[model samples]
Target: MAHTTSHAAPFLSRAGILVLFLAAQMLALTAGAAPYLGPEDEPIRLNANVTVTGSDVRLGDLFSGHPDHEEKVVAAAPAPGQRMVLDTDWLTNLARTYGIEWHPADAYDRAIVYRSGRTVTPSEILAAFKDDLVTKGMPANTGLAPGAPLPTLTVPSEANPPFSVREAFFDPTTKNFSAVAEFTGPEGQSQFLQVRGTGFNTVTVPVLKSDVTRPQVITPDMIVSAEIPDGTLKHDIIVDAENLIGKSPITFLRAGQPVHDTEIARLNLVDVPVLRNDMNREDIIGENNVTWLTVDANTLPPDAVTTAPYLIGKSPRHIVAGGTPIRRGDVIAAQQEIMAVASRDLPLGEAFRSGDVDWVPVGEDSIGAGVIVSEADITGRVTTRPIRAGQPIRAIDVTRPTVIPKDKLVTMIYATPIMTLTVRGKALEDGAAAQTIRVANANSNKMVLAEVVDADTVRVVSQQSAMR
Candidate 1:
């Protein structure tokens, strides 16, 4: 017990020595004028690239059966802190600017990486069109009728209802668009009718006023970096922001090939979607037992799909094999039919896609090449197709005319189109919108109540229904 008491004093003395060592370090740090040094406080210079319209600013025309209003919110120095504008057109432009050079490239020596099967370069089709435009060229535009084995060149027509596929092509370097149609309903009950055609074929399909038309365009100019053309693209250009910190390199690549430079450059390409009108992948084998959809409820419109273009990840669904009928739920090729905007509207520039929107989160490869075409190439008018209601839409079960009035037989009975109006505020999302409009028929001047179908249209119940 006595020995333990003596050891306690020694233990306390050792603890005091440890405290003294820590105190010395604190004194040394404060002893200096300043203890530590860090990164120098500096300002970063904000840079911007100002661009105007150019010849390569690709333009295409598409007829809006329905209003395709888009909201455009851009930051500028002028008036309002926030501005709102309604847009009916799919205005797309692409140009390259100079920045700190991460990799400067020349047009000639620089091998512009050309992605194969990226776009449908209509040159070969157009080369065929030279032959086609001669034989069946129209002074004005129209749609080609559906046919079997469609040719490279398509001619628009107004007379036909649903057309057939004309011809199909197989090119080693270029893969063409193809469609397979079969008479599933009463059209060919006795025969196993099937027809395979190319993207060059056209058809007369009904459209709503808000709908946008797109075409199957093939061009060497506008190409996709990845084989798939979703808004999200792979095979993107790496900017190397950390390595080239201060430099904003205008760097771009295509199919792993650099297109633009790290410095000032000229880029002349527009990014347009290559419409895969038919279902099968470009190189996959065609089906023998084609299955056509019913014209009644089963048919999907041209613009039926809200999602971007994608291949159905399935095998063909064959009803019969070698004329032997398979039971229900057999494994055929997977068939995915997305309602497409009329391709006729996509003559060159008129095609509208969700990918064209600026806010769309896209890969660097999607921005690499800009589509270049004239305004003539980019736009097309709405198809003169009359809107029809499926599922036997009834207007209050009105009595059929004992003596049908000539005016009642008009294609559409709705309000006069005041204009494709637009508005922005808390009440609106940009694009074309409508104001208060009255609905009436072509003959009667009496205004009637109507409901807004879309930004550009109003629907009215005929006077006969209300009177009864």
Candidate 2:
């Protein structure tokens, strides 16, 4: 019985091996017939966003797990520059039909599709129309005026879209034109726009290349030419470059605009003498203080001094600022005598010395009648009022030094043709040298007129002369 059981076990093993080989063959046949589902662990995922430049949207644009049939077209793409959203229901139906192992995890599962595109600007369209009009017997220097505003267009993004103008018609007599503008995409889609405008003859006018301020001369290098409609030209508009060059703007001028004759003036420049530094009143203007500045004659004040000779050796009537043109009224001619001016500040009762004042040439019109002109007139004299430095001194500002004070005892001298006598007296009032004052005799208390000769002496006048 044990030998029989061992033989039966070997036969059972051979039968089991035959069944396993058949099952493997069946699995291979099933895999070849059905679509390839990737490894069991990795499931298909829905893309949240998609962008396409082609006419149709493929499966690969909405799912990421399948590659063998990803190029299969599922739906048409939206128009250029437009977008569309696919809901979860539409995505589930598409996945089941394509055998993609994907299911919406939530109701929010969706994909948004956008077709890339670019805008054709109005200016670009106008440029194409202009080129077409030129070939149709229009002038090369023609400016276009559109009857209606041109519309901007949207086309698929292409490196160089095929833009062209066709069916262009122009009437030379009427100066009117009409054309069809078209732009084509890479996928054979196209857009057409109609354009209508009038063409007019244009004239080239000189314009400033940059903003120019007043008093700045416009040179050839600062100007460029621009074309404008000839009908828009006015009588004041300057067309020739010769009129703009070597001219100065009256105010400010902007770039790329036509210049007007009234806005600019012909340069009639003259060099006028100006102060190199500020000059105070009565300050003399010398060659070193003068500078020459070139300016437009029209901007100068009337009777403005233009030469250095007119300003040199002159004093200002008032304070004049530097770097400004001097006018005839602004300055005075130094034709009067030399006058004494305080070299430094002088206090009241301070005696004047030679070094205390300076002799300077002064204008007669600027000085008062009592102004001192000689240093000798002020020397040894005391100031009655405080005097500032650089100010002219008047006769009333100083007086002779006081030599005697009131109520002081002084030696009084009485002299005749042969006899001379001296007496002690008291001064009745303060007296300066060469001034006469009344004195009282200290012994008899008699009053007598005396001339002060020194600090301690007074000469009594004769009775006959004192009575007069």
Candidate 3:
């Protein structure tokens, strides 16, 4: 009716208005759509549906095991919030009229983790959400409308198992089955089972570990693999030998008296060659109850102890009375005073102690100088290596000397480089490989029955010949 102001429609404004109006209309429709009712025989919601989702999808699968599932409806996802709180006031009213109480499950205290497919009504969803919220550790009474989308609740997994074996058994005669089952429960859920065994093996294989490349597990079930004892051990001993106190009497003689072959018969002391059979290891060297004879008295100078064998102007006896006696070694003691009667040196002079000594003998000279004995003298074998004129007489220094008692028999010839040798022959009496046999100064006697050890050696000893 009048010149209206030229103004174009504001598209943005119009569109916004349209959107607002549409939203208002939708809200009004949704609001007026339905309400919680007390009407008998009525559904909580009319013709509406719901859905739910969360980290625990299996939780939904587990829901199939819930009770009265038919009466329950899976609704849409609730708005993002914790808890599956139910409006007890509203549900109670509905139950008063419909005779159905939507009380929580026995495990209601625990939050229900929603999987992608789990859904329920607003009230039910609220209750479930509240249950999920509270049980899932969320505060209670959290509000959630019908279209509220629920968050994915995380479900707990199993913890590391303890190092415990379930059962053990021992039996090998029967075929039987025995086992222990392993399982995992809900975060707070727990259970246990102990199984007694019957008809089991005394040895059985153990459970193999996954990470280990090698498998080594032995159990008590394999009887065929058991170890058996073969037998027990026993020991016995026989009388080999003992010390003899000379079945005859001992006659003492003057220290330096030389005995001709004729005088030996009249004398009591016998000059028997010391042999292995004659002396136990304990006798010469001494052990246990056997005492080491005083070499000091046994091999004193001709004038001191062995006057029976000393030769005048030839050699002085070199034996001791208070020292260990050797079978073929040298001896030292108070000759003039301190003196050494070595196998090669017959030292004569004063007294000797630890300090006045210059040289000493080391054992049988068997192995690289055996154990050396201090404050002790030697007495074994003494054969001269060489000799010189005016030299003090000694067993090891004499070259070609004759015994005064030439009438007495020479029983043995030691490692002699010359013809008068003690040869070891062939084996006899089964295992006997060697016997003592003496060779004449010039004869290579073949009639001699000597068992041989080495081709060129023999021991100078005879029991049968002596008895004959």
Candidate 4:
């Protein structure tokens, strides 16, 4: 039994040793199969959003919690100012390829990658093109008109990226140009664009600083200089400051616009007669009552009286206010003559008295020939015909007072050298004192020429005496 027990002990001991060795080997194999943990043992996770500035997108941009191989490039980055989405399948394939310990949570899981950059403005591009053009014999301060609309360009946001023109061609004769513009990116990458346009020389011209109304004088302060394209300048445009200063605008002039030669003119001034003081109708305006005003002829009324001679010795047709410019219809020639006119309607055979006539002043052209101008000539004269009130009395309108009416019985007296005879007669016609008229003898019924003596008396005269 001792011998069997000793032998079994050796076998059992050897078996235990082999078991311990195998268990140790199993632990070594398990440990070798498991993943290694670092100081930061967080799980690898998929990033939902990411932004990149470089041209390449790396594993670090699409996932977190992995730093050892995060910089490994996974894909090309999207263009500047653009975005790309990494879906679950793409993310899974990328992770497997790069050995990243990350997986999408679901099929809908995605990472949106955006590239940050800056847009090159149109003005910046133009300035670059212009600089290149200037170096290529183009005129300085030249204006440009693009042939077609320029395309938008974007570059990585860096500190003042270099923008330049390459392969530029310009024709001084035709004023045409074409060039390729290049923008250097942050990584020394370049973006090229084709540009084509026309060039024009500029000219500095005088422009109005403010709006001016018609007849308003333009002074030096109202003008300003501005640069304009030479092609836009017209032949009649006023370019000199001297041409615009002290000139009046023919019409309204707008600000910041070029003035034309026809738009401005030398001020034309005229001396116009104006009333010095208020005057009523029929009041004479003499030299003392009028004043001359210098006014722009273009702004004056068409019928305005500009001469002082026209206003002097004239009377206002209606009440005129002071400082009012005299017009052709406002005044008439002043009354300069006195003429006899009827104060009231005078019937035929009615004699005019002091109260029946008016001696009024009239213009020289108003009086006619043979018009009685003296009040004495019309006071005691009888009207030969009916005369209206305010009508002038003429020589044919009035005559001496009638001493005997027609068909009236009158005493006819015949007077000779020493003999005087009286007889009853009838007047054949009306007669005034000393006027010759026909009378008929009542007894003989014979007509004889007689001289009117009184209201009821006539003197018969022989044919020889009448003729004398």
Candidate 5:
């Protein structure tokens, strides 16, 4: 073990200080007597670009100096990008001014040469870029978003180059900024780089007021709103305090932590049915085949069917597995019903009554479009063909209520303001009640438009038009 102690800097006596001053004065006089007779100093070897590390730099360190001799010549740190030469003549003049009695050796004419001593670090480049943004009206708190790229500072590793910010453009619409930087080396070589970053704005949002180690229900009083600078927040963050009420966290939320949408879900949920057994295509679902489950309403799809009535009578177009969600595509409408199933089956040419046909819902698309008959359209109508109880009603199964038969004799009445005349006529086309059709008058053998009144009777216009 070694002893260690602290001490102050050693102080020189007043007599010793005067002795040093007189010795320096005597050396200056001796140096003036001998014009070039002094210690031989080698030339200082400096690169084209040199970076000065400190303010007080000894001039003797740059060139060869004796180990025993003291050098009093000092120089201040040079500014960035300042270029200058330290040739033999310049060095000699600097030594003369400082009373430095030394000269460069005859064999070496050059002393020290310096071109540029600028050290542009990555941090310095970034600071300058930020300063440029501030001069152009950027906010003090403005910065790059998390994970944003750093400035592309590609200065030479071997030398420090002069750097300047050429342009810093910002676009408010896109919330992005770009910068162009130019770097010049000592030998006049130049380089440029373009850097970009996304701009973010600081905002205030509600945060949990206390730490929650386990998943707990959130309440309005448990949170407080605060302002903070954030660039990594998700897009669907919950910023309002009211939105936090009656919500349960999926994970633990620490105190003063900002609330996000993914962390919590609303406690209010709706109960919907899920299939318990596999449902085949066109199979009508029943109440007993499904089980109810509670799910968050926000998580449900917009077209999700929630009620049992919507699925009970509806038929599926595809097979639905058990435990799967019952959606729009899994079910078909229960509007298609068979007419004959409502009543006892009727034979061909039998008149159909409201009680004679059944309107039971079926799980088939056999009824073509536009041809589906409703109860009002089929009441008191006769079926043209044999009817099956479970078969869907078709257009060909029923005929129109024909009041007049084709090619049949009919009484055509011609009425006038004063009197009415009746004549025999033949029906050219089958006509229903109040239907207009062509009828040939038996007496004149001329076809005329007439309205069918009954099964065997028709009426013409006034006597003036009927006569023509």
Candidate 6:
């Protein structure tokens, strides 16, 4: 019996030692894989902030604290304000291969917010949470971010759930926003997570794309729509390219500047006549020299001519350039006059008669404005100088018919207010009616100035009067 007991004791002792060694190995493995096997019984330590870089994220990025460095977990990058599961079966298999423990029941799913090409700091995230809380009239603070200490959040038991945002509302008058949230607890589900906070009302509207000076025409390329704070424009302000295109600007504006209803003017259509080429005075304006143009009324002069009659048959005051805008004051009607002109070219010393001249309307400037000769005064008169057809007859251009021939006897009269004396006088030169001539008194043979009143009749004029 002693031998049997001793042998059994050695076998049992060896067996117990082996079992203890196996148990110790199991404990060591569990301890090494403790981090991989998330703590489900304990509160979930949510890392308030998790930063993701590049276009993709991996599980190894979230579990960098693990002792194992061999991990190739990959997943699509999460957008800002998005939640995704970073841990998958492949990660679990990898952990298991490395002798790490993992529980499918553990809450390994994470909510991630990523920023690409933009800065979204931890303070900003915390402030967003605070604002949501403040919006709901709740005073709470969870100042945490990626590098900051992680906060522990004990999710309620299955019978109760944590609060979550469901919907949002905005108040334009106050520029505030409120979020509706839900919280399901064992007692009942409560969705009164009303979060109210200040925010901006964003709007997209067309604005000037560049600086425009006064009198500039608005074009489609001059405006673009951009997002900005709302309530900055009036009700009637122009915000579309169609509404602003082809419109004239009454004032100046800078790039990205807002426009007002009164800042732009509607184009007014007007038709005007324009010269096609440089024209001289009395140049007839025909289709070749003039054209009708339609243009903005504001661009034309106030008195721009609109009719063809205003331009045709009108003489320009000066040389008018081609395409020049026509105005009422730019032209005038040429002066006209009715006067006697030679019917045919008359040579010097040729006798003038009614048959040699004709009355016609000619340009006043074409002939001198001084002397006017009548047909009766010009009948049988001799031309003093050569005259051309249409040339106006002037008193100096021709001589009156001779009433008393040169060296002929004529009766001369010297009349006074109280006495009249008649005497015979000799004509010194040819004379006509109302023509002044030099005569010699036959009674005294003294030369004196006298007027031939009629054939062979002469009236003596005082020497003073004759000198005048």
- Cα distance off (Å), candidate 4, residue 54: 39
Candidate 3 lDDT tens digits, 151-224: 33222222334112233222234322232322222322333322323221121111112211111121222111
The total of clashing pairs for model 5 equals 4
User: Model 3 reaches what TM-score against the true structure?
Assistant: 0.15
- Which residue runs of candidate 3 sit more than 4 Å off their true CA positions? 5-42, 45-179, 183-190, 197-468
The superposed Cα distance between candidate 5 and the true structure at residue 237, in angstroms, equals 18
How would the candidate models be sorted by TM-score, starting from the highest? 2, 4, 6, 5, 3, 1
Error of 5 at 95 (Å): 99
Per-residue C-alpha lDDT of model 5 across residues 71-134, encoded as one tens digit per residue: 4445553433343445677667766764455566653455332323445555566566767887
lDDT of 6 by residue, 48-138 (tens): 3456544455445545344344344445555433445444555556446644444345555443534232333333333445465457544
Local lDDT at 140 for model 4 = 79
Roughly what TM-score does model 2 have, to 2 decimal places? 0.45
Tens-digit lDDT track for model 2 on 269-336? 98888999899776888899998888999999888998899888788888999998888999887676
lDDT of 5: 0.66
Structural similarity to truth (TM-score) of each candidate? 0.11, 0.45, 0.15, 0.40, 0.32, 0.37
lDDT of 4 by residue, 1-468 (tens): 999998999999999999999999999999765543323767777778998977889877777766766788878888777899988898888877766666676789999999888887777787778778888888876867679888667777652654667988778888888888888654547768888989878887898998998667889998998767888899998888888999888878999888899888887877788988899765888899888777678778899988888888888888888886777998888768888888899999997776888888876555789998876676567999999998888989999898899999998888778977778888889998888999888777788899898898987875433321
Q: Provide the global lDDT of candidate 6 against the true structure.
A: 0.63
| Over 4 Å off, model 1 | 1-329, 333-460, 464-468
* Residue 344, candidate 5: alpha-carbon lDDT: 65
CA shift at 97, candidate 4, in angstroms? 62
Candidate 6 accuracy as TM-score: 0.37
Ranking by lDDT: 2, 4, 5, 6, 3, 1
Model 2's C-alpha root-mean-square deviation from the true structure amounts to 12.6
lDDT of each: 0.26, 0.85, 0.29, 0.81, 0.66, 0.63
